[model samples]
Target: MPTLSESRSRLLVSEAGIPVSNWETADSTQEAVSLAKNLGFPVVVKLCGDEIAHKTERGLVRLNLKTEDAVEEAADELLSSVTADDGEVTLLVSEQIRGNRELIVGLVRDEQFGPCVMLGIGGILAEAVADVAFRLAPLSRSEASDLIDDLSMQSLLDSFRGEPAVDREALINVLCALGDLGSDQEVLSVDLNPLIVANGVPIAVDALVETVEG
Candidate 1:
């Protein structure tokens, strides 16, 4: 299996009607700066390439950049950090999203069960919490709704602090979209982490897709 980079994976989800953070690809530091300015201050920059799959672990991601200089510096550092094995690296400038709630949605292939859709509590503590639910695909709107209800931490979906309650319809759409992908023969898996709830709508900030050669 081959893993798609963040930008490519994001495109896949976006095409499936999943909301994603605003972003653009940049081939140079100057281009990155220009894109960041257009996206507004407080953006994120990441080194992206087909072969650079584990960017965060490799220090290729920069977050909360508030100015042109910051974007430029981060873009330069990210580009410079690329290794020969990384292939053709580029910069991905994305809008910064903030929310108290983070959720995960994905598709996986189980040898015996075929395709399955997953939902869970996401972010850095995802592994520790491990609050997740799985359902066989392709899920109907009703099944997707039930899947969301399956999570043990239902309070996380409710209005918290000052943020509005998560829009359940939007989340259902996401799960259905993943289920749609799971039915595709070429798609091996899809991972959307930290689906930040902004203004009650879930938006994917990062994604990864694993695929098989057709």
Candidate 2:
């Protein structure tokens, strides 16, 4: 099995009608700084490579960089860190999104159940919370809605700390798309974690896709 790079994974998800944050890839600190200027301040710099997962754990992710100097420094560090390990690296410069609500949407193939879509409470503590739900692929709108309702932490979807309520319809569309992706046998699994809800809109901030060998 081969893992798709985060940028490629996000592109695939975006093509499936899921909203994603604006981002650019750069190979040098200068290019990264230029991209950050165009994307505006308070951007995130992450090392992008097929071999690089759990970027935060490897210090390959830098967040909330509010200035060009910070972007330059972080980009340089990320490039060096990943290059040291993989010999080549690309840096993803993305808009920094602020949100309190986070969710996970994924696809998996089960021997008995076949393809299934998953929804869960997401973020750094996602594993700990483990509030998740699953439904067969190719879900109907009603089934998607039911999946949302299945979350144990339903309150997170509501307006919290002054933020607007999550757009349930958008989330349904995401789940439905994941279902469609799962229906494709080539795709083994999909992971869209910390799908941040900002001002009621859900944007996938990070994504990964695993595929079977052809």
Candidate 3:
């Protein structure tokens, strides 16, 4: 597998037919403000440099910001919040996505399975419910069975009484792709938590990826 050894290039997550906000790479303070006007309405700003991870935890990400002035202010604030140990920082300003729920899809390498996939109810309640399931890579229909039979979180996927049910099949597709990634790509780490499934469909709201070391 070809390892992601370059620090200058960022991973691009483009999917055909999926409606996502266009993200602009802001190289400077003035450029950030100019990009915001074109991005329109409410937006989110974050440090996209290789040196930064845990942006939310570090207070390096700002949300629900509207207007060029707020963007500029937030941009400066985000830049100053964390020091760039990697020398320079690249920033991203994107349109904000609105939703109430959060779901997680991720991968963890297992010695036996090589690369395993994980899915669960995300956010604060995930811990309480322990709503998570795992499956081995190169998943087929039979492998998806583990998610239904072995995982303790199946109840969350259903609709009882007045509640609505999520698109279960769509979730399964994500798992299949993760399995493919583990087998085909040298994926060290990935966090697609809180994928923002709404009205029975899933879209990645926030994500993080790291290259695996051989």
Candidate 4:
């Protein structure tokens, strides 16, 4: 399966009614700086391309840029880092989002079971913690809510460290949207990691979508 670029992945989920952080693409450092200014201070810049997956692992992502200079520098460096193997690359500038909690949501096609929706505790140690729940696609509102209850780290869903509790309805919609997206024959999988609970609303800050073709 070929993974869509971060921008494309975010667009795919957003079109499915999944919430995502505000972002824009720029072809040049100046354009990136302009977009960052429009998005307010403390932005994130990334080198995005259809062929360039695992950006963080490749050091193509620059986060917490608080000024135009920082955005410009990061954008320039990111653009310069691209190689022929990266196919085509563009600068993605988005608002910097923060939260005390993170969750993961996704869809997968099981060879036998077909499509399944997943919910999990996310962040840097997602795999280490391994707290997750899964259900067959085309879920009901009630079934989607059950997936939330299935997670072992229940406390994470509650108000913590002065942050509000996770917005259950919004999350349910995200899961339900993934379920709907799963039914699409061309979409192989969808991964939304570190769905930041900003002011209690789950907003996907990073996403990756696997599709059958470009």
Report every candidate's CA lDDT: 0.90, 0.88, 0.64, 0.93
Q: Candidate 1 residues 18-88, lDDT tens each? A: 99999999999999999999999899999987787777778888999998989988988888787889887
Query: What would the per-residue lDDT of candidate 4 be over residues 1-214, giving only the tens digit for each residue?
Result: 7999999999999999999999999999999999998999999999999998898899998999998898988988898888989998889999999998999889999999999999999998998999999999989999999999999999999999999999999999999999999889999999999799999999999999999998
Pitting candidate 3 against candidate 4, the one with the higher lDDT is 4
lDDT of 3: 0.64
Better of 1 and 2 by TM-score: 1
C-alpha TM-score for every candidate: 0.97, 0.96, 0.78, 0.98
- Where does model 4 exceed 4 Å of error? none
Number of the top-ranking candidate, with TM-score as the measure: 4
Model 1 local distance difference test score: 0.90
Arranged by TM-score, best first: 4, 1, 2, 3
Cand. 1 TM to true fold: 0.97
Encode model 3's per-residue lDDT on 1-106: one tens digit a residue: 2222112222332231222345776877789888888888688887776555566667777788888889889888876665636346767877776555567777
Model 2: clashing residue pairs? Answer: none
Off by over 4 Å in 1: none
